[model samples]
Target chain A: MTARPVLSAPPAIERHTISILVDNEPGVLARVIGLFSGRGYNIESLTVAEVDRDATLSRITIVTTGTPMIIEQIKAQLGRLVPVHRVHDLTMEGPFVERETALVKVAGTGEKRVEALRLADVFKARVVDATITSFVFEITGQGEELDRFIGLMAELGLVGVSRTGVVAMSRGPGGI
Target chain B: MSAATSETSLTGADIVLKALRDQGVEVIFGYPGGAVLPIYDALFQQNDIRHILVRHEQAALHAAEGYARSTGKVGVVLVTSGPGATNAVTGLADALMDSIPIVCLSGQVATHLIGNDAFQECDTTGITRPCTKHNYLVKDVNNLARTLHEAFYVAKNGRPGPVVIDIPKDVQFAEGTYRSPADSMPKSYRPQVKPDLNRVEEAIDLLAKAKRPIFYVGGGVINAGPVASQLLTQFVRMTGYPCTTTLMGLGAFPASDRQWLGMLGMHGTYEANLAMHGCDVMVCIGARFDDRVTGKVSEFSPNSVKIHVDIDPSSINKNVRVDVPIVGDAAHVLEDMIRIWKARGKQPDKAALAQWWEQIEFWRARDCLRYEKTSKVIKPQFALERLRAAISGRDDVFITTEVGQHQMWAAQFLPFDRPNHWMTSGGLGTMGYGLPAAIGAQVAHPDALCIDVAGEASILMNIQEMATALQYRLPVKVFILNNQYMGMVRQWQELLHGGRYSESYSEALPDFVKLADAFGGVGLRATEVGQVDDVINEMISIRRPVIVDMCVDPKENCFPMIPGGRAHNEMLLGPDEKVENATPEDGMVLV
Candidate 1:
């Protein structure tokens, strides 16, 4: 029997990060996520905050994998929530900057320690904390940039890692 | 900012009333209490805004949900604070999950006493934050116009949902002004409906290339109406796509279409599902990938690449990973798809798709969604069949339902030949939904038949609606499948819940015949199978609010069920599966 193509499209696909402005209410996010989760859409990274101080509005930044066609659709639906005032596809709008903050800790006294600092310095990652046997590095950038930095750290005595999920915004004057 | 409008004096209650009146709100369901006495008193002055008083706060909210779901208008509800505000939670939660539009205004304790837990004080906005689509806490009377304006806008626009506003009792007594309607509501508040032409073009391009294409229309299409219907058929003809709907999406297309897959999911047709599973492309419209439709997520439609069209942006990649996400109202986006397809001068190979249509027909011929076996007592299908015969092809007729074995049976068997004739609480899965919804639908279209197909236990949740129906003199037909048990739950309990029935069976029931008779309407409680046709004929002859307590097979459980916590396609059907004939001869066995 011929196998149906699973993971058929790509060997390595570029992942894009997106953030949406939604109403800060109970079912708003669920309705948004339900739109995804109900349909089997996976959000690689999701973070929501009631950015409008009055708590009347929320911004949900979601990082997902797809072609540009899929990204446009996500923007359109996010604009449809009653509470949703606007939607911004940070990836599509040109020249937008992206960042993800990660707290990394590695414990070692041998050459692994020297290697960790060497890699951290090269990545421009900072040591927020250091002890007799361990060091904690603080790194912030696009998820991929952070991932690459963590990958090199992982082999060199990676111990624990804490990440604040994705938060996104548009590049220019108009805000969603 | 203008003195001409700003200086005008209007109490908070006056502002609330004016805002609602501006929205053309003709009816509101509510209850009175200490915190909201001023608003209710002001309501007495607004002759145009009619109020319906319900026995319970929950009833008011459900009625509002029903109104919103039926009329496609913002459902407005009012209740006092504390217990009153808390009571509306169920209805809010129900609307929230289902994406129905409802604006609930709750009275709060005086603002100064808010945190003290003073009498009738409640943080309605906070308590409802998780359940409502959006909620507001109005601290000043001056903000009343904008708050109510935003509440209505938020509730009715984009992924329609419930919105709540907490009004302090003192605010209602304070003075405010709402002279300009535009001032009350911001211009930026409208939901963007322009379809993504690029995504639409891409979808059409994919459709043109697809050899086996299927379009799954959902309730969102029905909600989008006239425009949605106009665009859907246009797309199907151009794309040579066979379109089907879920229970919620009934009227999105003509059931008579050879392209129609009559509802798809748990109780959905075998061939329709197989066709979806085997399709080269699936265009999912306004429908979330509900578990009932996609049985096992991993096993769902392996061969098909999905294209989800929904107005909510987050839904695009939420559930099933979509190849193409088209965000806009189902109707609006469909319009763009049709336009793009026509502009491209593309023609689908209809003949090439004939084989797939034949496959759907093959399934239709083998096992159409039917349960027809003429017998002794009234068969539920006969009741339905008779209802079908009685329909005069009126485009306005609506059939809403409560969730249960009977509900599945209705969705499976009902012949909704026209659009807008089928309605139900799909996403919320709220039972006891039929009676009030039927009444609400009847209220929306007084000249049309607004009928409800309900189960015995489910109807009891809002049986008082019979009074509402009779009060309105609505000719809404109520079909109560009185098997004296929670049939759907029991079927699962016996089949999967270890056969140790726990509260799944109900033996005590008030005589529904007398109940309807006392309510000043018709009630036909038939037991013998032969009575099915006769009682249905009699009930139709009256054409009024009536209840037909037909004795369905007590053991006549709905089949092709996907046990709870399982995927949609994984049904509990086997060759050994048997339900009682439930005929008088069997006396309806408990097992």
Candidate 2:
């Protein structure tokens, strides 16, 4: 049997970092997540915390990747969520800043231990905890920078890693 | 009515009842259970809001939707916790998709026992959040009345949709202040209703210069109330342009009007779809460009300068980009359009539109709805036509339908002369929507003839609602076109799935005559075409709940179908019909 011809779709996947302002109420976060999951939209990373305690508002930072059309649909669908007050695509709206924190644990000795310590210092990672066999370093930076640090630590006996997903804000005076 | 005194005096249940009364809620569709006993007790004490106890929670919600759609008001529903709330999910999603405003009051397990897996306890607010416009859980007694009022406000205003208020059992018994609508206005939520005049002017400019134009309307006009429908009619009449309505927009403009092209998209008329494809200028009012309507968006109305008038900002440019986007209520924006057009002293190009009408007439002459009549079996289209002919001259008739081939047949054959006369599950295409909706309409308009044009498969979805009609003594006539299959699915299977029937057949269907009798209602059946008219007449003459099962030709399929994923111009005509204007096929492009 001959193979059927495959219709290739455009392989241009772009990552979008979006910030949403919403009511800090029970199930509000679930609702936002449900909108993505129900429609089968992919969310790469998501972080939410209460922002204005007095005003009862929360800010959710979501990193997702899709085609241009899918991204537009995601934003439109998110805006239709009742608790969501504002949705900003930081990636589309000019220059923006994003950062993530990771805790890296390295188990090593001798030259590997010395090299790990030297690399941590170079990456501005603080030693939060230490044991005889392992040291846990707290690193905070952009996703790619943290990825680089983790990559180096992997060769020097990386044991475990934990990360807080990307949090983003538009690079301007105005807030979403 | 003093705030201080009432704040210290009223229990939560009493507060809810009083607030509902103040909001002028005349009826509520509900099912009582363990968690909602306290609210039921409050309901027992009051006679202002009549409660119709539905057999199932889903039917309660569907009935409320029917009530809302037929009357153009916020429908109210009340149900107990857990399964009761879970059962209402389908109806809630249906109402949300159709932009029907319904306020569902659901009982919950007491506050302290909420996440402890208490009996009849479920995460109602969590479950319904994605389905509702807004939802609230009243944790404290003090917030109950305000939250309830706010739910109503959020539900009925701006792109109307269902809202849920999950009231914990303890909160229902605890004392709280009774708040009125005038007292508790939502601080954070106020929808912008008026359109910017600049956008209105832009739309008018586009409309005036058009050589070929078609007005497309949807259910949003019906939700905007009678004034909007009146304005839509006025504007369409003034322009003298051809108009086509989505299934939801059926009655917004009188179907009898000469300018009317029948419901467009999917199973829409050949003329309507052709007009949509060929128009140079398309004015879309109160209608979202749903996938069913637009077909393949890239090829939808390819040469048109589109103007979309909608109440929801999110709806505009969501599916298709438009030249002019006016975000406002249908009535308000139409008023502005009329005003701007008059100010410019511009008339539609009559000579140019005459040529467009000539093209539309050629498509119309094809009679896409036509089918060969037979003496042996009742065709679904002929049944609806006979039903329509029997109900002719009756202006107070309301039509509701379960989804599928029968629904499309009803849209094609029936003539709705006024707004709010047609109610069906348009967006969600919920199957068992018709029976309960008809009961709801009958409850609203007791003297009006309310009919549920249902299919055998779809009617069985919410068949238990027949009990609600009997209990309420509602004069609802159920006209079931018994084709013995999920006809639409069967049609797709025949055309697209190599004739694999799958599980689309309605096996062991109930005998409607016996079933109606068992439910304490009248039942009629007609197997032959000769018996169709007499049975419909008998069904109409009944002053009580009636079911008329008209057995239709099982092999017949809904035609003039824009087979899913195909463009509007590429329609599949019925059997024995010649294809008109066949485009050159790429062979690789298969829909």
Candidate 3:
């Protein structure tokens, strides 16, 4: 008898940024989101916007984390949705760019406000609004970079924050 | 002015009927209400499309499913809004799981009153989105004809499933320009029907060289139409490989063939399950590796190099990772594989195949289907065997089954020789599916014998359908194996839960014989072994709808079970039978 192959270990859980192109119609986004929530798939972040007015096409970017098998299931399931035209896993498809924009509001005195501005400057954030006691800094960067900027501002008397989810694009001439 | 030119200036309700006629929808199963009165009036004005009024909206969908499965046509359903649409949810889910092609048209409140929590209003499209293949909410009369055609196209194409189209009352009253299906075909929802020849060639190579090979077929073959089943029979016969079918795929391959290895799964035959576990090359055609078929997924078919062919791209690699995955219609792929295999002219290893057959024969000799005989009371298996004998030579017989021990026993004992003859809710395991489905099948085949193999508990779930059968003069038989309990549930509790019989027992059961009489149908009863055959004959001879209540042994349990979390080889043949490959450390996992 031949030696039996050993059972492989469970696949690693890693985040994947998937982009989907779908018909821009009512209930299309709900169908995409319902699939993730119904199947118990973890959705870390999501962003959607109409991409083409003539074609009535919309692009949706979803950040999800799971094992390799689960990731395959997510993409396949998304592809089966009638309105969805294409699904591309940016993480697996070579180089890609992902960016998120966050508005950081800080309410503090002299030192904390000055420190917040310094860190925002390092993170390439722009002060969109300013008052005597607070400033709303709009920062656009990769999620990790924004996390670092938000972390520094949290200790500097950060009051509120609003962040857009990740939106991704493949780093090539091709488009979805 | 004429039928051909009547397309222009037609009400939305008239457009619905015209689209159904264009799609060749001969009959629809539905229950009408206030919101659907306009459509019902249009239905009354038409003679081409017949509507069967079921007692409940759920039965309408199931009946439609039966009609679809039996005739290879899209089943049409029409029901009202709110409670009518909600009631059809279970049937929609059932059709989705079984891949039955169904187009359910549900009436909704006026478009203006949709979100106002108006009387008899519900979000039918939103509620059915996850279950249906696709759904549409038609607010405009102009889009009604196109949406109706699209609903039919989506329901029956590729991997077939149920679709819902919610039409508001206002839209039904508005005049619209009706378009033909040819002009209104869906542009964006095209599914790939042709498979890559490279993958087909790869699969042929594996089949040619395999020492121990088996064909695992599923319901997709039947859904692909009878031509697919014919090609499957031809391909499997040409290769001379052993074959086993899933519960939903009972009639795709002739069960009487020498190569047949009965049904394979939890309560499958010992030879079939063991062959699946031990085969070196496993070719899965049109069947997903569902959890019930693959116990403890990681250890399932561990040694087999698998080839899976399914039409749905999403279905591939969902449960079990396969070596060769071909996405295409079953018939299309099978035709290609046969051609490629014939051109290559490669054969399996003869000596190794002989040894494999010898091993299979050894396992088959165990006769795991044998149960202890009892003349005092009717055993469910024995009753099924008698029923099979009674209908052995009948060529126009179709069987539908509810979910329970009776369904498993029917699968084990009943042998189907042709495609579309066996209809059962396999994936969803719905209890009330059989009777309504039988009504639907009877509607399709007016003179054919349609019988529903049901249990005492399950028969009660859709007992109201008996009135539907009587009203339609369907003459469908309801064969009830009256165990006086939810037999499967009670058995599971007895074996797995330390004999703690919960609410599984049917405490206040109706007298089925009298109930049949109450429904203005013939009622037959068989309480002992001697009367079983006589009762079956009498029931079959009756020209009216009949219910045969065969009192069976209450404690009889379906056997040859690979228990939850157990491997294929680790089967429990019967209650007293020894557990194969029993390990003390092997935990009992709850399903």
Candidate 4:
């Protein structure tokens, strides 16, 4: 039997952090999320918060991965939503800031516990809660940093983990 | 905004009527129920907006679509909660697909009983979120008028589409200050209606240098109103370029014009499809590259430097990538294109263009639409030809169709010379869209002859709309090409499923003549080829609603069919001699 030769390799998949400014009214979030799910666009991480009090506007940060064409479609589709005022692709629009927070709970003692604390210190993770057999660490940083800290904590008896999905902003003085 | 006196405050139901009146909505196609009793009561007190009560909620929405498409006005629909709302979903999706501007007001349960699983209650907004262009759940009475106005604004704006407002029953009963459309402008929604000058210039540059250029038009031209169609005709005339319309775009250009190449797509004419495939420059105005239009997307207009003009920015590059993408209303873009073309004073390569036209003429000589005519039985194409002969050259004649082989035949045989004269469920392919749609058109233009070119099986899907036509006194004609089976499905089965047939046959069919008479309308039947033209004339002459059942060859299949997943060049022009005798396996590859 011969292996079938690959007809074509797929296009490179790139992650895009898109920020959408929308009315903070009822079902606005659902509308944005529905656009993603309905169109079969991939959403990796999502965070939303009310950004303007007087304007009643909410900012939604989404981490999505797709080919360049699909990413363009995502932004265009998001911009087409009725309540949406603006959509910015942070990944493509020059330099930007992205942050994620994670809580790590490690249940261990002795050398293992000491090692976990030392690693937390190096990662600049604060020990939010400490028990005789466990330590709860509060960490806020880029997604990769949290991922590394969580991965290291796994060796030190990582019991539980909670994370707030990544939130993004453009580095320059620009508004989305 | 505070609590006011009764003189200033009006109930939400009254506000709904007042807001519709304010919006200059002439008519509303609706069906009332338990949740909408308050609105119905308010409707009883009103006289401005004429309400046409359709038998099914689905028919109401489709009827509204017909009204919208024919009149270039935002079609209004009203239906009660749950079943009523669910039924309208198909029509909503249809309007969304076709970009028909329709505002649908669906009644919901009492505000407090919303999530309690109360009677006749569904998550109307949630269910309709994906289908509608935009939707709202009006919870408060004060917001009712604004939402209604905003709904109209959203529906009729750039890339017009269906919008839904799910209003709770209590909100209808509650009193709130009524506000006009100007007071409650849309807070955040604004669509780009003007094309980028640079992009327009780029498109003009492409058109100017083109050797084999073709204008591929779609329904957006019609949705942009009559001026877009006029601009398209003018632009095409100015360039003297070959023009072809998609199924939805049929009447945007004069079908009788010398430069016209029938409708282009799977079942489109040979010359049109070939021209599309062979073109060096393709100027696509207000038409998305739909799958039906672009058979085997990878190979669609491969060599053409394509320019796409659409009001919706997202529609551009959604399916087929274009070299120049202009985001604007069809009218505005065409106007700018004309201005720029005139200012630049650049002409197409005449020598190359002459060769292109010669090639197009050579392809046209094949006459792919010519089918075998038999004296013994009426072919669907022959029937449509006779019907077309009766209605042709009349500006007031409008045609709607159910989705099937008959619809394609109507597109092939009937030449539309004006925009909005042709209305069919192009995007959603919703069956039974014809009958109610015809009624809606008749309601819009009472004196104009509106006809639904229907198939036997597809017409039965919403056959109840015949009653709606009679009740409204709308003299719409239903000319059914009565083939015994679901002809399209049967044809596909023959090609793809080894002629299994399955359940495509329609058994226990009703006596359409008796059914029509029972509803107090005229029904004419013609089984013989000789009687086709007579019945069509008689059906047209009648002032009341009529159904002409033209029995056609049951085994006949629609031709010029680029089978699914096939390239445009691989279309099967049906057998020239005898269509009924030719099986799918005869001289054809499966794929």
What tens digits encode model 1's per-residue C-alpha lDDT throughout B1-591?
Answer: 476755689999988998888888998888899999999999987699988776567767777766776677888889999999998887888888778888999999988898898997877876787688677888888888888887887787778889899999989999976655566664345655777687788888888878788998887786676668768877786676788888778767877777787778777776667677778899999888876777656667888878898877666665577799787888788877877788888777677688777776776674644454756755666666666766646566678888888888888777776555666777777787777777766776777767788888988888887877777687777888777789878875666445677887887888888888999988887787666667767876676888888777676766555444344344444324443221122222322
Q: Compare candidates 3 and 4 on DockQ and give the better one.
A: 4
Docking class of 3: medium
The CAPRI category of model 4 is medium
When 1 and 2 are scored with lDDT, the better candidate is: 2
Residue-wise C-alpha lDDT for candidate 4, range B1-591, written one tens digit per residue? 323432388999999998998899989999999999899999998789899999999999999999999999999999999999999999999999999999999999999999999989999999999999999999999999989999999999978999999999999999998876877788888899999999999999989899999999999998888999999999999998999999999999999998999999989989999899989999999899998899877778889999999989898889888889899999999999999999999787889889999999999999999888899799999999888788777899999999989999999999899999999999899999999899889999999999999999999999999888888798989899999899989987777777899999999998889888998999899999999989998998999999888999998988888776666777788744333323233224422
Best-fitting candidate, measured by lDDT?
A: 3
Per-prediction TM-score, chain B alone? 0.92, 0.97, 0.98, 0.96
Which has the higher TM-score value, candidate number 2 or candidate number 3?
3
Better of 2 and 4 by lDDT: 4
Interface RMSD (Å), each candidate?
Answer: 5.7, 2.3, 1.1, 0.7
Clashing pairs in model 4, backbone N/Cα/C closer than 3 A: none
The residue-by-residue lDDT of candidate 1 on A45-86, one tens digit each, is 888878887757777888887655455556655555456676
Worst 10 residues of 2 chain A by lDDT: A1-10
Which structure is stronger by TM-score: 1 or 2?
2
Runs in model 1 lying further than 4 Å from the true structure: A1-176, B1-7, B186-190, B372-374, B541-544, B562-591
* DockQ of all models, two decimals each: 0.16, 0.42, 0.66, 0.79
Query: Residues B185-294, candidate 3, lDDT per residue (tens digit)?
Result: 77578788899999999999999999999999999999999999999999999988899999988889999898899999999999999999999999999999998898
User: What's the candidate order when arranged by decreasing TM-score?
Assistant: 3, 4, 2, 1
A35-82 per-residue lDDT for model 2 (tens digits) = 889988999999999999999999999999988877888997787676
